[model samples]
Target: MHSRRHPIRNAILVIVGFVALAGEVGAADLVAPSVQKTLEASFSAKGQATLARLAQDKTQGLCTHYATSPIPAKVVTEITAMGFATIKYPADGEYLGDWQRGEQIAQSGLGKQSSDDVEKPAGGNCYACHELTKAEIAHGNLGPSLYHYGKLHGDNDVVKKYTWGKIYNAEAFTACSSMPRFGHKGILTAAQMKDLMSLLFDPRSPVNQ
Candidate 1:
């Protein structure tokens, strides 16, 4: 006499058993190359989204390989060093811009996509992965909420620099973070970054309030 498993649990167990039979790592190695090739062949380039998007850079390749596994200490060091080296601080001493404009940037989800207009400047799309403001009920929970970020962490020079660097290259702080390299990749302009900074750190900003 044994307890019965739920339908979904049974389905998952079957899949796990199949993977175990195939040898987990071995199956991944055998199928990944074919899957990558198929993806490359099937996906078409459009607008600013070129076929090069399929190509994995050094960091991307490493991250993808370790997606389901714990990264080695040496590899973590290497990845963070690579990411940190790419960060470029603002030439102008100013770190904060208009918070009102920052709010708009946070709300905007426009950026590089197949159908998007190439001429238009891409947005930060911050809210898509973060809970930024109390006023904006529609927000994602993928990343930690930055509501009262400035209040929680005082606006000091150290905090400012660290914030700027994190926004620039998230991988610099956390290896294999899903956050985009907005500043490092030139996805956002210096002025735009400053505005976003204000959105995060300004006392008057809705995020801080």
Candidate 2:
């Protein structure tokens, strides 16, 4: 007769293995082949999600490795540099679209879920992690309140570029940030990004009002 192992025990083994491997490896990489294999074995492909999701990219691998301790300045610099290199500015030099469309994008949380329509454009889902307006009482506190964002930052080329860059690749500013790489990873299109820009920069937007 055989006994099935407990899930927590298996997790602990992975962590222990990670520590041992870290001592041998220069970077404290957590996604060992075994770890990835285990993760892949747990989930079957569903809808838009695939086994490829189990694989970690360089940034993700680095972030996971450094989760237990502070990242060195060298690694931080590398991460930010990689992020900045991935941004692609609009051809027309425009940084904003309609604020009304932006409002809708910010409010929607659809697009990336397993059941979401892949053909449809993804939403910014901004309110999930930020307070964008006083009227909307429901908002998460994970990220900073963005209400009055335009009033506080002021409108200018510098502000506009910074805002666009930040949205495109937040990790360029704050390494290992949980914010989605909306532009860097092509999660949001150029037009969608402009709309989100308007949501933050337009005076008439609820974020400013």
Candidate 3:
């Protein structure tokens, strides 16, 4: 005897198939101009944050495209090169600083918001995405756990330069890293970055312990 097909099951299957197809079709479509217009109308410039934040630079545009689809090798190379080239190394030629100060900078998550005082210095916010010291139990792990970073790697020239560059602009190493461009974007001052570096590399620092 032949089994009879349920009409409700058939209808549900058809609806699911149509939904999947519509999703695929919608994936390639650009964001609606109306949405952009709405954002522009709603968002007001405040303090350090400005309307220019809405505009995507070359790297940002490429990153956005890569999120939706595969980015070409040449584009990735170009983006990385651009990021690397833009790094502004410390003019005084000092790379390390007080680990205590660095720890404070890394732990503090203040500055750059509209509510924050623009005159005050910005924080590194490194602890937000990395595990720096054993003492700090409240740390995120979006990036690798950086505890004992210098102990494991040793304070070699290569390690020092790479650490500096990574903190300066994470995108220089990774095309679409979630880590902020701390130094390049002026999120943290050179002195603040040096302090964070010390926190990472200093043998006396709690991170090394």
Candidate achieving the largest lDDT: 2
Candidate 1 off by > 4 Å: 1-36
Compared with the true structure, what per-residue lDDT tens digits does model 3 show for residues 152-199? 999887888889999999888888778888888889988989999899
**Mind giving the per-residue lDDT tens digits that candidate 2 earns over 1-209?**
12477764565456545844675323335556676667677778999888877666777767766766788898899889988887788889999899889888888899888899999999989899999988888889899999999999999989899889889999888899999999987778999999989989899998898
In model 3, the runs with Cα more than 4 Å from the true position are 1-35
Give the candidate order by descending lDDT: 2, 1, 3
Better of 1 and 3 by lDDT: 1
Using TM-score, rank the candidates from best to worst: 2, 1, 3
Listed in order, each prediction's TM-score against the native is 0.83, 0.89, 0.81
Q: Please tell me which model should have the higher TM-score, number 1 or number 3.
A: 1
Error of 2 at 50 (Å): 0.7
Candidate 3 local lDDT, residue 177: 76
